[model samples]
Target: MATRADRRETNPDLGVLAGQLLFAVQRELFGSLAELGFDDLHPRHGAVLAYLEVDGVRATDLSRMSGQHKQVIGTMIDELETLGYVERLPDPADRRAKLVCPTERGRAEMVAADKIMAAMQERHARRLGRDTYAAFKTAFMDVVENQRARDLSRRP
Candidate 1:
């Protein structure tokens, strides 16, 4: 291990590690997506597409789930809508509000994303040993959950 001073100079903190992982995953995912004709999508679009449901979801819920601001979600919705990936329809339960529903293109993209993610995970698991990869995921998720809980509690 490096000395304390060296570590401090180049500390790989939790945030840094998380961001690196995110960027790497996005690079791989988005590159493949573009090759498959989803050239319109970007890393930011993952905020909405990654967690979207087949039925539809509310922008507020997407914001909460993705830890993104409401305005950001709305803007992504608008962009996706214009790109013919999503449509905002009147929510049946609450006509006052709209639900963000995927178009056929969006659904197809979702399916492709699922396959790509699964293949990536499997590749990583094989490289790292399945058990070790599973343990790492569990540990990472624990960290994520704890941080999310703490952030939520601190919110006004």
Candidate 2:
């Protein structure tokens, strides 16, 4: 019988494997957030929340940073605003635009998300061994930087 490790070794799609790991982590983080009374937020909100600045950021910038369409980001922001996680305010710098700022509730959720992710990392470290986990993080970050550079180079 083929072991799980053996099957993973033979899996040709690294992107799929990476996506699977990302989804698993997101699932665990969301579950933890739900326990903390943040069950209203959905996983899709992470795209916006992950790129949100501490002070505030314009919706267009958020859309660019998150690689989400402006309309899609608008919809997510609307949902988040309704849930009291975020609010759209007039942009001082650009009177014609609005900035999406995190509410107090949103900040609290961010902190909770951080704690949950930290716990998840600790568990993964324990399972993978501290040294292996550290190396894995470094490798993943290097890959991210490389991809970002490649993407930049492709820009006009």
Candidate 3:
């Protein structure tokens, strides 16, 4: 019998290894942030804060950008509100939709988190050597861009 894996063009072994490496990197990154008293944050919340940091966004827009379901995004928004990290504002353009904007406290938290993350990056760079680290970063960006391109291409 043919294996289901054979249906796909991509190599399953390489895909699994790539996912493992990505998860390992994320674990290290999240652990570093946890040391800075940000252990409460999840990956989804991070995506939301990063989105709001870039600009105020609607829940629908956040869902689209974060690749999260609207209901899940709503739950995240509820948690954020309770944490005093974000607030809902009446959308000036659309009466029915509320805009999600980060509060002052949220901005402060983001600043602190950024500092922690930057230090982590610097430490990793130091370990890898500056020049080698720079090359690695570029390669990582290339991989991300390529994956994004593939995703966009496959979208209907």
Candidate 4:
């Protein structure tokens, strides 16, 4: 055991651990994405890309899913549109609104990202034992959900 002179927290907290994990995975993912000829995409765009659906999704919904503001989502959508990864179409239900639809290139990127993330998760599971890793993921997600619900975040 170690002793500290003051009563300050010396260990990493949940936020630090989660943030480190996010950054490390993002660093690895973006590097691989570049090698795969997706150098145009950046980590900031992930707020939109990571939560996209096959059919289509609205920018407002993407904002909620990614826990980002609608303005941020709009900017990312614009960038993706310019890069030819996505397009906006009139919603069938409401012509007044538009749906953010992914193009073929976007679909390909999504598939690549999914494969990479699955591989990373598998590596960790192998290192930590499948059951333990599964339990940890479940518990962590529960904690996140609880905190989000309890906190005063702008998100719904």
Candidate 5:
């Protein structure tokens, strides 16, 4: 029988592989969060909170960074606000605009998530040797940076 790893090796589509890994990581993250008493949280919420700044950021900026529609990010922000994880405060630069800021609970969750991700990386390093894992991570980041550069170059 062909093992899953063998199958992945045979059909090596980086995008598909990346997506599978992302979903697996998300599952583990969600499970860990639930165990930590954040059962109400949704995986989609990560799109906004994962890259959010400590000070706060405009909703439009979050939408752009997350590559999500403004309305979609708006809905997530609303949900987060209702759950007391985040708050929309008037932007100091523009009173008409709102900045999304993490509440204490949200910051706590982010810390927990960081720990979980670190543990996950440690496990991967163990499985694939420390040196090899480091190289893999560096390569992945190079690819991501190149892609981001290309994307930015296309913008007006």
Candidate 6:
């Protein structure tokens, strides 16, 4: 009787490998970002920060971007505000709504995150040849785009 583990051992799941690699990259990126003295900034908070860097969005919009609830995004925003990484300004279009913007500190953090990512990329290219790494990146992006399109089609 071949058990599930036996099957997995004999023919490991490539999807699992991809997922594990993604997680490893995220962990390294987050850890490197955190070491720059940005306290309590988890992956979710980082996602919000990155999003806000591009646009000043409302909490509801941020909730959608972060894939979190409005209240959760609000809570994270409050913490980020206290940390001086983000600030809320009154929305001109909707006076009742507040727009979130990343502060100078937040921009600095973003730059640090970029540096970390670049370092990681260079390390990956050093380990795997540059051409191989570039090919892998292209294939990964293609899969990501396909998955995103599939997910959108599946949405009710």
- Give Cα-based local distance difference scores for all models: 0.94, 0.87, 0.77, 0.90, 0.90, 0.79
lDDT of 6 by residue, 13-126 (tens): 767767778689778877877677865677767547756753478888887666677888888898889988889988889899888877888778878887888999999999
Q: Ten-residue segment with the worst summed lDDT in candidate 3?
A: 6-15
lDDT of 3 by residue, 7-59 (tens): 34354564676777667756765676667666766666765775675346899
Candidate 3, residue 153: lDDT: 89
Roughly what TM-score does model 4 have, to 2 decimal places?
A: 0.90
Give the residue spans of candidate 1 off by over 4 A.
1-5, 8-11
Q: Clashes in model 2: which pairs?
A: none
**Candidates 1 and 4, the one with greater lDDT:** 1
| TM of each candidate vs. truth | 0.93, 0.81, 0.69, 0.90, 0.84, 0.74
* Per-residue alpha-carbon lDDT of candidate 4 for residues 1-156, written as tens digits (9 for 90 to 100): 554423225776677778988999999998899899899999998999999887889999999888788999999999999998899999898899999999999999999999999999999999999999999999999998888777746545
Ranking by TM-score: 1, 4, 5, 2, 6, 3
**Clashing residue pairs found in predicted model 1:** none
Clashes of 6: 0
Instruction: Give the higher-lDDT candidate: 1 or 6.
Output: 1
Clash count of each predicted structure: 0, 0, 0, 0, 0, 0
Q: For residues 1-156, what per-residue lDDT tens digits would candidate 1 score against the true structure?
A: 798668645987787779989999999999999999999999999999988888999999999999999999999999999999999989899999989999999999999999999999999999999999999999999999999999999999
| TM value for model 1 | 0.93
> Model 2: per-residue lDDT, tens digit, 97-143?
88899899988988888788788899999999999999999999899
Better of 4 and 5 by TM-score: 4
